[model samples]
Target chain A: MECKLIRPADLDEALAAREQYTHDALPIAGGQSLLVMMRNRLVAPAALIDLEPIEALRGVEVSSAGISIGAMNTCRQLIASPVLGEEVGVLPVAARQVSSTAVRNLGTIGGNVCHNEPGADLPPALLALNARAAVRRRANAREVPLAEFFTGYFETVLEPDEILCRIDIEHPPAGAAGVYLKHAISPEDLAMVGVAAVVVPDGKQTGGVAEVRIGIGGAAPVPLRAARTEAALKGAVLDAETARAAGETAATEVDPPSDPHAGADYRRKMVSVFVRRALLQAARQIEENGHGAA
Target chain B: MALLELKVNGQEVRVEAPDTALLLDVLRERLALTGAKRGCETSHCGCCTVRVDGMAVHSCVVLAVRCEGKAIATVEGCGDGMELDRLQRLFLEHGAVQCGYCGPGMLMAAQALLEQNPAPTLDEVKKGLDGNLCRCTGYTPIFDAILAYGRGE
Candidate 1:
C-alpha cells in the first residue's frame, strides 16, 4: 500500500521527489494500470508520486519540428486534438481502439508506453510514424528512437529514475497516407494482431514509394517494425502486387508465441492479412487525399 | 494517510484515507456512497464507474487521494432524493433494469454519454457504453432507453 501520495507542483519538483524516493516510491500517472496491479498485490510501493499535477508533462505541441506529445496527455486528449486529427490521423484511429471510453478518459500515452503491455495500440503507430521518445533523469535528457525504446515484453531501456517526458513524431509529408489495422477478439479485448503502415510516394519517380514503414504488434514479445516488409516496399511501385509481397515478408519477420487467446500460427497468418489490408488502405488514402500518387 | 478534498455530487467533502486507498472503497465505506458497486475490483466491470471531472472512469482503480479537487459524481448523485433524472426515468420506462446490480454503472455511463453527446446514434451509444457490462437485459433495452432519452421522448 502507498503510504504517501506526493503531488508535486511542477516537473522539477516531481524530478526532485523521484530522485529522493528512487526505489521506495513509484511515479504514477493516471493510475489506471498501476492501481490494478496494486489491488492484485503485484506491486506495493511505500509511496505513490502522483505525476498528474506537473503542468510541463501535459498537452500536445505542434511545430515545424513535428508533434511533441507530453507524456501526461490522455488517450482522450489525443483523439480530441484537431491538429493530431489533421496531421497524424492514424494515431487517433489507434487511440480510439484502446480499452474503452472510460479507460481512454484516464489512460496516458506515456503510461501506455511505460507499462509496455503486449498488443498496446499506440506503440505500433508510434513505430510506423518514426517517433522519438524524450526521456529525462535529473538534468540529463536523451532522445531515443521508438524502435529502440522497448527492449522486451513489459520492458524498456529507461532506467528506474528516468522519466519519459515526451514523444516526438515527424509530420508525415502533406500527402502521405497512414493506416492502423487492429484485430481483437472483441471490441474491448486487447488486439490479437495489429498492424500500422505509412506510405509516402516519391515526388520524382512515377508510382514509386519514397518511404514505407510497417509496424506490427501482438505477434512477438515486443511491438516491432516490419523491417523486411519496409525494405521490400521501399522504392517499389505502390501497387497491389507489391503490397501482397510485403505482407508475406512481414509474416516471416515476427516470432509469435502460442497462447490461449490465439495460436502463434494463426497470429502469423493474421499479420500477413492485416499488413496487406493496412497497406492497401494507406495507398487508397494517399490516392483520395491526392498526395503525389503518380 | 492524506486528507483528500473533493467535490462529490456537488458537495465538498474531506476524508482521511491512505494514498493507495481506492476511490471506490473510499466512496462506499468512508463516504457511504454505495451507488457505485464493487463488482470486479479489476477495471473489466464498470460496476464502479463514476465521473471524475465529468469523464467516466472506473472508481475501483482510481486512487481516492488522486481525485482531490476534482468534481466526482457517482450513481448516488445521478438522482435527487426520490426524483429521478430524465435518463433514469427513461431507463425504467424502457425496461432497462434487470437484476439491477449493473444499474448504477449503466446509468452513470449513459448519463456521461448523453452529457457529452445529446443525440447519439445507436452505434455511438454502444461505443459510449463499451466499458460497462450487464449480464441481464441482453443490452437491447438499455440501448433503447438511452436512445429514447436522447430523442427527448
Candidate 2:
C-alpha cells in the first residue's frame, strides 16, 4: 500500500487532519526514527501528517514564567539556542550527545519525548528539569508532566487525536546545578544507563542540598524519577558517602531489561555507578561556578 | 505520486516520485544520481548522507516530498565537472579510500563539516564523521584527509 503525505499549513489544519485521520495517520517530526521504523515494517500508517509546515510548531520562546520550546525545533536548533544554554544548559548538553551529527541535525525534542524509546538522552534531562508537554487537539489542550508522559517502551500517554505542540519548563531554582551522564559503549549508541541529576544547594547549610531530583533512563521500562532516592537525599549534606548511598538507593528503584548490549545485572550495576558520578559531578560544578548555570 | 521541485547541485530539476519515497531512492533510482550509496536503510550507516539546506542528514530516512524546496548536495556536487576538488584530492593523497564503498558519503560528510568549520580539530573531525563507518581504512586515513584539508594542504 502507498502511504499518503498530508501537509497542513497551520496548527488548526494540522489538528483537523489529525482528528480526521485519527489512528490511520501518524505525525512525523524530524522523521529520524519514524522513517526507520516504517522501513523496518514496525509501523505502516495510511498517512503521515507533516508537521514541518506548521509555523506554530517551530521556535523557542521565553516568558516571565518559563521557557516554551516548540515541538518542531530540531536538536541542532536546541544546541545553538543561546536561551536554552543560559536557562536549561543541560538540554543543550544532552542535545549535543543525542546521536551522530547528522541525526541530531534533524532530530527533535518533541519527537524524542513522544517516541519514548528506551535509552534516549532527552527524557532524563527533561524529567529532571520538570518539563511539561503541551498537547493540543481540535478544540482543547492539556499539559502532561514529563514524569507521567512515558507509559512503556516506545510508548507515551499521547492520544491518537492529540498533537504535542510544545514543551514548557520553568526556571530551575537559584543555585541549582544539573548534570547528565550516559553509559554507552560508543558515543552514538543509546545509553546502557543514562542518569541526569539536578541538585539545589541549601543556602543556610554548607554542603547540604535543599532538594535533589534524579531522572533515569534505559534502566527500566520507562524513563522515571528516582523518588525514593530523591527523598533520601533531601536536606542531606552531599559527600562521597551520601552520594554512594543515593546511588545504591536509585539502583533499587529500577528494573532494567537484559539485552545483547548488556545483562540486567550489568545495567542495574551501571545505574548505581553513573548515578553517583552524575550527582558528584553536579555538586562539583556548583562549587566551581558558584551556581548551576552550567 | 508527487512532483518534487528540488535544487540539487545548484541545478533546478523536477522529478516525480512516490509520496512516501525516500530522498535516497529518488536521487539514486529516478534521477540516476547514485553518489549517495544505499547502505543500511536504517540510518545507522552514513552511506546515504547528503546535505539538505547545508545540513548533513541521512537521505534514507528523509521523505522526498519533504525536501521539495531545499538545496540538496550529494558527492556529485562536491567537485568541478572534470577535475577533482581539493577535498577529493586530499582523500586520495591521504589514502582514505580502501574498498571505496564509504567514499561518497565520507566526502559529503567531510565537505559539510569543512564548510561549517573552515578549521576543525582532530576531535571535531572525528565527531563530524561519527555517522560514517569505513571497515577498510580504520578511519585513520579519512581523519588524516579531513585534517589535511583543514590545514589547507
Candidate 3:
C-alpha cells in the first residue's frame, strides 16, 4: 500500500486532514505503534497525517489545575522532565519503566494509551492519577476520563476521525502519593501484571486513608479502575491489614487471561501482591514526606 | 513517492521513495549507508538502531519522511577514516564483538548514552545498552568495554 506522508502544521490542519480522509487517514504521533502494526499488515492507511509537526500537540504544561501533557511528548521526554517527575511521580516513574531506550525515545504517551495495549505501563498510572484524555474532532474537543477511556483490549472510545491531542492529569491531593508497580518477566518486557496506587492522607484523622485509587492492567481485557478495592480502602486506616484486604479484593475483582508468560491464577496472585506493595509504598511516601503532593 | 531530505551522518542527502518507506530501508538501499544493520524489522531487536536528533531509535519503524530536518547518526558516522571511535576501539579491545553483527547498532546506542552521560554508572550503562542484544560475549565484556571507555582508559 503506497501512502502519502502529510505533515500538518497545526491542529487545524490535522483535523482538516482527518475530516477529509476520515478512517482512511491515520494520525502518526510518534509512529512507534502505528508503524509496527503497518509492518505486520494489521493496518495500511492511505495517508499518514504526521502529528509531530503540530506544535500545539507537543509540550508539558503545568498549571494550577493540573499537568496538561501534549500527546506527542515521547516517553524519554516525559521521564526527563523534572516537573512531571516531582508532581506526578507515578507518571515519570511509569515512563521510565517502559521498553528500552530505543523505543522510549520514539514512543509517545498518546500512542501508548491509544494503542491500549493490555500490558502497557502508562495506562494504569494514568488511570490512577484520574487523568483525562483530550480528544478533538475538527472544531470540537472533549475530555474523556482515563478510567472510562479504554473500551476493550486495544480499543478506546475515540472516534475514527478524532485525535488524542493531550492528556490532562489533575494535581494530586495536597497530601497524596502515588506509585506504579509492574511485574514483568524482564525489565523491558510487557507487564505480566501492573498495579498503580494513589493514596491521599486524611487531615482529620492521623494515618487514615482520605482517598484511594487503584488501577490494574494485564489482569483484565482492559486497564480498569479497581472500584471495589478502592471502596474497601477509602475510609480504612493506612495499615498492613487494610492494604491486604484491598489487595485481596482487587485480586477477586480482576479477570486475568492465561497466556504463555503467566497463568490467570498467577496474574491474579501477583495483582494482590503488587497492589499491597504499592499501597504500602505510597503510605510510606506519605509518612516520609508528610503530605503535600510528592 | 516523496522527496525527503535527511541530514544523515552530518550530510544532507536526498532520497526519493514511497512515504511508507522506513528510514532503515532508505538508508541501507538508497543511501548505501549499510552500517545500521537490518535485523528483526520489528522494533524489538536493536540491530537497526540509529540516532535521530541524538536519541537512539529503532530506524526500522521510523518513517523516512518523518526524519526530515533531523540529524541522524549511524555507526558509519561514529569514526573517521583509519581512526576507530573510542567505543569501537574499546569494544575491540574488550572483545565485545564476536560475530560483529550487533556491533554497529550497539556502538550507536552506546555513543548516544555516552554523549548524554559522560560517566554513566555500571547499571546505567547496562540500561543504556539494554535495547541492543548481543547473544555473544555474555554482555560482561561489552559492559567492561563501555565502562573502560567511560573511565577514559
Best by DockQ: 2
Q: Please list the residue runs of candidate 1 whose C-alpha ends up more than 4 Å from where it truly belongs after superposition.
A: A204-207, A292-294
For residues B20-139, what per-residue lDDT tens digits would candidate 1 score against the true structure?
789999999999999999998888889999998888999998888777888999888867879998888999998999899899999988888999999999999999999999998999
lDDT for each residue of candidate 2 in B1-153, tens digit (9 for 90 to 100): 988999899999999998889999999999999989999998899999999898889999999888888899999987786889999999999999988989998998998899999899999999999888899999999999999999989
- Name the weakest run of 10 consecutive residues (lDDT summed) in model 3 chain A: A285-294
Whose TM-score is higher: candidate 1's or candidate 2's?
2
Please compute DockQ, using alpha carbons, for every candidate against the native two-chain complex.
0.80, 0.92, 0.82
- lDDT (Cα, 0-100) at A22 in candidate 3: 91
The residue-by-residue lDDT of candidate 3 on A6-106, one tens digit each, is: 87888999999999999898888788878989898998889999998898889899998889999999999999999998888888889988989999999
Better model by TM-score: candidate 1 vs candidate 3: 3
Local accuracy of candidate 3 as per-residue lDDT tens digits, B1-153: 888888998999988988778999999999999999999888887999999999999999898888898999998897795899778999999999999888899998998999999888999999998789888888999889989988998
How much of the real interface does each model capture, measured as fnat?
Answer: 0.91, 0.91, 0.82
Q: What does candidate 2's lDDT look like per residue over A165-190, in tens digits?
A: 99999989988898999999998998
Clashing pairs in 3: none
Q: Top TM-score: which candidate number?
A: 2
Candidate 3 predicts chain B with a TM-score of 0.97
